[model samples]
Target: MKGKRVALLALFAAVLAAVAIEPAAAQSGADSTTEKLIWDLNNQLMYIAVPITVLVEAILFYTVWKFKNNESPLPTRENRRLEITWTVATAVILLFVGVASYQVLAEPYVTATGADAGVDTVAEDEEILDVQVTAQKYNWQFNYPEQGVTNANTLVLPTDRPVRLNVTSTDWLHAFHVPGMGLKTDAFPGQSNYLLTKPTDTGEYQLYCAEYCGVGHSQMLGTVEVRSQDEFQSWLAENGDSGGDTASGNETAGNETGALSP
Candidate 1:
């Protein structure tokens, strides 16, 4: 009877541990290609670092315990083979990390095109949805020049479709960062930056200003709504302004044309 109670308690403890650990392991991600690559690199580096950290700590503790309170200690000779082995091992590990990082960066999904450089890789295709982003003191304005729509603090996107954003600031510097989409670009005054992404899931994601601008920086918040292609078209039709080109048209034209002014 006593043995059975102890076994039950141990099983209960194991169940509790698993429950506690599962949520931490299942943290949400950006649900995009760029974020997946970054997370893969992070997990791989942790796998490589954890064992080395444990081994070094074990060696340090053992050395301290073995030589505790020793008045006289004999001189220890260092082995040349050990030194060479560690050096070579470290070099090989670094080489592996560098190669892996380079491969991820080389993918076509991650790219940066200057303001006046060639057409944006993502935007070059005819099927792309272009949204011009304007950043100010504490707000973000998203303009769909093609659809003739201007939305403030809310960016709407169509799922499963490629999106290209032209980002620039009017007053101060800001960073347009959407963690769920794994897209971030700087909003510089008089200069344009670009970011491309495709949201696979249909949900609302949070957007934030990654750079600190002023006192209202903490309140610089926005939302990105991902909808189906049909729903997106319907939204554009309903909310779009017909007469005025509220969204400045800068694509395929001069760079200074589409500055989102007040």
Candidate 2:
């Protein structure tokens, strides 16, 4: 019994330590409004979850410690009050999770679907840059439909402005993920998925294909370069025609499965 008690205490301590260290480890270096929102949501959930976890673990440990020596323990009596209390608490927690998740998912910058397709709801006066993202076996292509510019393996966007990414896969299914910006969406073949975000900082962020495609899945990596509006416009003008041809040629040569062109 003493050994069991010691093990339980150690487990309780480990749980507490894990809860304490989770926030720091979970940080993704959010640098955009949508990313910040996601970060905030994670913290919110942690705040709620930590306390409940502690409470439940504490009760479990206490019960074990208190009843450990009872060799001829009596049958437990049912307590309606305790039962009702826990049931209500569980319902409330579930409700909170549902509402919080829905709030984040329903945001225009997080997801734009149904009747809100192609609509810029982030700001009325702000201009939204539309970029089409195409994923193949081992590469990514970002095309600015309005500017008639395209780039391979690198996505460029203007800071402080909303960006709409129409993501799709040319061959196999892939996922477009920018961890720093909290942007992730499935890129299905023949279907375009929209993801919206506003960059709050000017820096290079890492992009990855979150799904497994083929032998080259590990190499299916990309970069997101966020720059000032003026610099972004300059880059568009410089690469408007040349960039498209270069990206097309590179993709055509690199494509092993003969996927459809972006």
Candidate 3:
């Protein structure tokens, strides 16, 4: 009994060690919603599954040690209740996991969904600021259509209001994912894409290409800067560039462009 208890305790300790998942070292800010979902799910899953696993293993080990009969055939028994109990329990747990996490799936994405965001969309209403996000083989562009401002590699937004981003790619398919706000949108050539978010916290969040576009796909990176409303207006004035060379006026080496919706 003492040996069995020690084995069970060891198993439980091993299970508990895997439950604490730290955020990725390379990422910062409140960007990825997936990370938040991980935070929520890990605890529940650990608590639910770990003990079950440890207990089952402990039982198996105890049986092997206590009931080994090398000279005789192993006893075999059929227990319908045990089988059905396990099956139903597993199904119930799966169903609960799905239902409990529906909020994460239901959160509105950062998209004004143009060319398709429908005639009457909520994005039109929450349009405190409008910045156009575009994706290419390896870079991102942010254009402020209302202010006629454009730039590459960096994005700015105002606090406490809905910021609608109308986006599309001039090249292959790419995903604009920022972990902080739990937001991402696909940028497709010709066809338009949209993303919308309200940045409650003020900070800088790193952006990534969530899709594998091409050779330079992994090199693509961008940043989003959230500021106060007044500061944001000042930023619009300072970084604002004439839509003249604004037709993909990437001050950088190689850049791409696409038409964005209001």
Best by TM-score: 2
- Stretches of model 1 off by over 4 angstroms after superposition: 1-26, 114-126, 242-262
Candidate 3 per-residue lDDT over residues 228-248, each given as its tens digit: 889988977766655435445
Ranking by TM-score: 2, 1, 3
Model 1 Cα lDDT, one tens digit per residue, 50-116: 5565556556665677689887988979889999999999999899889888876665455546433
| Per-prediction TM-score | 0.74, 0.83, 0.69
Give the local distance difference test score of model 1.
0.72
Tens-place lDDT per residue, model 2, 69-124, is 99999987999999999899999999999999899878877776732443646667
lDDT of 1 at 244: 31
Order candidates by lDDT, high to low. 2, 1, 3
Off by over 4 Å in 3: 1-38, 41-47, 60-75, 109-128, 241-252, 255-262
Q: Cα deviation in Å at residue 183, candidate 3?
A: 2.9
User: Residue 17, candidate 3: how far off, in angstroms?
Assistant: 5.4
Q: State the displacement of the C-alpha of residue 226, model 1, in Å, after optimal TM-score superposition.
A: 1.7
lDDT (0 to 1) per candidate: 0.72, 0.82, 0.67
Q: Write down the lDDT that model 3 would get.
A: 0.67
Q: How accurate locally is residue 92 in candidate 2, as Cα lDDT from 0 to 100?
A: 96
Error of 1 at 217 (Å): 1.7
